[model samples]
Target: MKIHMLPTGDEVHRYQKSIVIPFKNSRKVLSTSPLNGGYRENLLSAFNHDSNPGAGISCSLRTDSYLNDLKLLATEIGLDPATATGISTAASMDNVAIKAVSYENLTVTAIVTGGVEVNGGRVGDPASYHEARGKTVMTKEGTINIILDIDADLLPGTLARALVTCTEAKTAALQELMAGSSYSRGLATGSGTDGTIIIANSQSDLKLTYAGKHSKLGELIGLAVKPAVKEALFLQTGLSPKSQHSMLRRLKRFGITEDGIWNKHGVLGEKTLAKPVFIQQLESVDREEELVALTSLYVHLLDQMDWELITPGRAAQEGRYLVERIKQKYQLDVEYTFSWQSAEETITGMLANFTDVIARISAGGPDV
Candidate 1:
């Protein structure tokens, strides 16, 4: 693909391009497919996706049939199916994994999973182990584990851009089910401004399946998986007493019985709780930008979390469950092995802490 940028102004340029792709031993053809949206980014070589993977996106709907046709589709798009590898989900009686193919530009050097569980952190134990971990949330907060690996060249000073592009792509792929949910950086509600991030790198490390690839296959897969991870996040509904206590703790300053925060995207009601799959049934005609905006707001909402309520040492990791499910339901058996960079329970211990937590849970905690 050759891109021609002619100066339209000191800082802006009009872009024109043509991509020549040879298909299945056929002659090369000049393809002039227009990139989505007429605008361009200020960043050099920055690519954005509308988050819609074509051919009706799905992870497990028809695994056998899908994989069988994947090669043909890859060839159609001028991609080498062999390089279209990396992660695959696998399940066993004991555990589930998302395995990577080979090292790509951006590799998965270490994975430090973070989350919260009231049961594990006994009373006053101050289990600081979970403390240092990242991205903690309440019971009502449903989230997914996204093992992302951007191009090594693109990693410099591109944190916010990469995150935005990635989030937008994923949200667009999910379309509706995730419309009600939001995400934040840092630890839960009250934690500092620490967005989801990468911590390490090396000369040789495992690739994140199709991560960091510049290929169209990699791009589509990335967008699809972000929403797919939603299923896993939904399963993380085991509200913790400490997490509840922390969530309710916010009320101490206002001295109110109800949760005051307002952004309420993923709150679950009794019926949805009873019928877990109901969460998946929810759909959206909302645009990709809306979900991306929601995620940005999630980063903003981190200020409300009472970090004091989280156990000191017990960070929780919950994506493996989804990996297993994808394998079981979709036949996408590829285990995920994050560089073992070392890495939850209980509700009723609830009343003991926040008297009104039941009400908040029942009513769906503050959307803010």
Candidate 2:
């Protein structure tokens, strides 16, 4: 919320940068047994058995506006925030960044990202729950793991789609932040041309081989705008005056007005979202510092997989193992492995959703 002043005259306006959101820790509180025991003793017994009453969970986010906006959008679309962790927004700013900061206000104390490392520390809490006769019931009880990341451009408040048009410019400005030598200098560069970067060196050859590797990066960027570009043809004949104007404004950013709907997806293909990559570094020695280590590892692994870029079988395998490890190490209670897809899938699904929205609007337009 405050601007950080640099040694140079100009100010580096850094926002709160990030916030950590915590999952619920409360359990169902049980009523005291009346006939068997008195209220206080009954409550004590329950507590002693590690089945005591639980406090109500706090409503999570620090800002009511965030919680409300998320719930409102979810309600409007008949979506469950829990089920569809992904959201489709035409807003200019990166909704992922905004929501991430918002979630930070709730329960996450610190966050970690990047690949697994011995320094990443062990997953699972050391805290233990005990039952009657003082036997340990659970090593760690009620700890929920959270994995989240943001991908869209500059995060803006809800507005007319005109704001979404601004994403192109906003994203460009954001990329400039990393070019600053302070963050880039000695870090492991992914390749001579590939903008993909890894921060530190590792003895692990898989990482070292790709340390500065940029293979396939350019090819991927070339494919970035395919879906959006493909949707533009519908705009020519089907778009209403207002929608057509919006489409034109977006086209202008990519210089596609001249090329007739060139693939602009290339723009996003250059770099993955900032948050996941940023978190990966933290994941290195993160376990000792935080509880969300599993979530961070999950996101980092998901990033490496790049959901759409990986085969479905590989993705399914990664997803399964990631969930399985969390379950085994943390003893977590989760719905199922299949319930959570790679983060890549979430982004791809989001893009598909955006394309669908554009198509629906085009079909419903007055011109149509």
Candidate 3:
């Protein structure tokens, strides 16, 4: 292990598969770690570990045993096992991102390691039933883990508030990237098994009473965390705005699949073109900026209707208008009729019809 001292006088030990931060002095800590979690005044160190269990290898560490395992790791790293708190992930430690920001007198730092391939999910999405306690069931999958440090003293309640600010910033980052939920037709807020730790300086004389959105501390926390999480995600999984620029990627949240579109194309009796040709043309059109922009608007309309900000009738009207614009712009000879069935049926029919039209247009020409 090699030690690198942070600007806040903390030493970060970088091991091959872990990053450990040992404070020069005991610090105030709050975390969702399975070990040494919750409020603590005498924490000596914090760490993030990568337990990369490969294929056919079991990763689910029993809770009773894993606690001792982490403690053993702590002791090996010259930290007091009784005073160390940490989180774990399958993301590579080499991809960790460290970001720091400062105002006139306050400094905030965020360290993040993120991977959202298998577990990305939105809040309120349906969940699979699982029962476990304290680090048990360590599945070998993606997760986002964050570690935060503040250079100034803060009240215990204020530290808790900082955690909230950090969480919101993380979600905002995922939203900006348009990350899709694994379980629903919604944008992911975070992975299902994410963890976070927030530490504040107990030795500093500058004490803060609040860390809400209005506070400078909160602003710094957001500034540090959002971009750090984004960078870490990109490093771990190649997710970025550029990677999400396709219409298919945008429409995937609505349960749109390539095979679904191809089936819809066959149903329309448009078998003149080969399936490979249709797919090639579809890929070409999927990247068109104007078409993607229209798709984005249509998706937002669906979202607005779902949120009750707009009526289904209004959304259908606007969606059909957008389709007309696409037809005119592309000069395609596709036809669609609106269904006034139940709201669910109407929405489903509209999406099916729209996707079918898109498939026809893609099959018609290369310039579409």
Candidate 4:
């Protein structure tokens, strides 16, 4: 075990299985942890544990009592289970990220462990249809667990407001990476099983009343949480902006898939290319900076049309312009065509045409 000291004079114990922050005195906390969740002032410690059940073990075969399991974990770590509240994730503690941001005397630290291999989703996405009695279903796949500690005292309202700020910051990190939603044609805000814990010093003399975006405290929180979440995600899942710079990754939210692209343009009636050749050519140009830029603009136009911020005709006009730019940039001879159907159909058709042109160019085929 390794120990690190926080700015608030508290010790953070980093163990092989968990990260524990034990409070020396009473502190105020607001959390979504299943063990001792909600507002609490007498909590002794906050923990983020790795609950990975190992390979080939199914969820049904795991322990059904989460609370009891957490209690046992707390005791094993030498923390009083009765006074501890915490969260758990399938992500390993080896991937935890610790970031601290300070302004003058105020300091905020964020500890995050993240994995989004599955269940990454945007807010308001579809839900899994199920009903459970007594115990709820838990998956040991992906979760982003956050623990925040503020050195300065804050009102209960401010602490709650800080939660909102921290959550927004987390979403901002995901947006920067353009993380996709599993359930919808949109970007993911967070994983379905994400959990957060926020702690504020109750003994500090400097008390804050507001933690909204307009405040410096909120700014610090964003500065700390956003990069911490991103770093944790990178450590745990190899997910970073560099890793997400693929045309397919960006277009997946719009219902475009590798097979969809390949099947749409892999063959021209009697002529066909091998699947490997097609994918190689497609991926070769997918990361072209210029092409990716045009794709970003095209998707933004789609978003604007969906939000009714731009008329369908305007989107079509601008979209055609972008498509033309793609052809000109790549020096590919292709014709511009639209189905003149619904706005969605028209815009998606433009994308399909754009992709088809690129694929043909990549395969060294004559313009159609």
User: For model 4, how does the per-residue alpha-carbon lDDT over 135-234 read when each residue is reduced to its tens digit?
Assistant: 4657456688999999988888899999999999999999888888878777789998899999999999879999989999999999999999999999
Best by TM-score: 3
| Superposed model 4: Cα runs more than 4 Å off | 55-61, 130-135, 365-368
CA RMSD of each candidate after superposition: 20.5, 28.7, 2.4, 2.7
lDDT of 3 by residue, 1-368 (tens): 55455656997778857899988886899999868998899888899988776555645663357677677767766778898998888888888899989987788989999977678899999867545533345634668999999989889999899989999999999999988888887889999889999999988888998998899998999999999999999998888888788889888888887778888888888777888888888887887888889999888877777677887787888888889888988887767667554566657867876797788777776565
Work out the TM-score per prediction: 0.23, 0.18, 0.92, 0.91
lDDT of 1 by residue, 1-368 (tens): 32221111111111111011111111111111121111212211111111112334422422233233434443444445443211111111011112222233432211111112111111232223463565332211122223333223332333334444444543443333322212221222211111132211212232232223374434544543443333332234323222222322232222222322111212423332322222222111112233334322322222222243433122111223333432343243244332222111211121112222223223332221
| Better-scoring candidate (lDDT), 1 or 4 | 4
The count of backbone overlaps in candidate 3 is 0
Model 1 residue 46 lDDT? 17
Q: How many Å off is the CA of 312 in candidate 3?
A: 0.8
lDDT agreement of model 4 with the native:
0.82
Distance from true position, residue 293, model 2, in Å? 3.5
User: Which regions in candidate 2 have their CA more than 4 angstroms from the true location?
Assistant: 1-291, 304-308, 333-335, 339-368
Report the Cα lDDT for residue 84, model 3: 93
Q: With candidate 2 superimposed using the best TM-score fit, by how many Å does residue 103's alpha carbon deviate from the native?
A: 42
C-alpha lDDT values of all predictions? 0.26, 0.23, 0.83, 0.82
Error of 1 at 232 (Å): 2.0
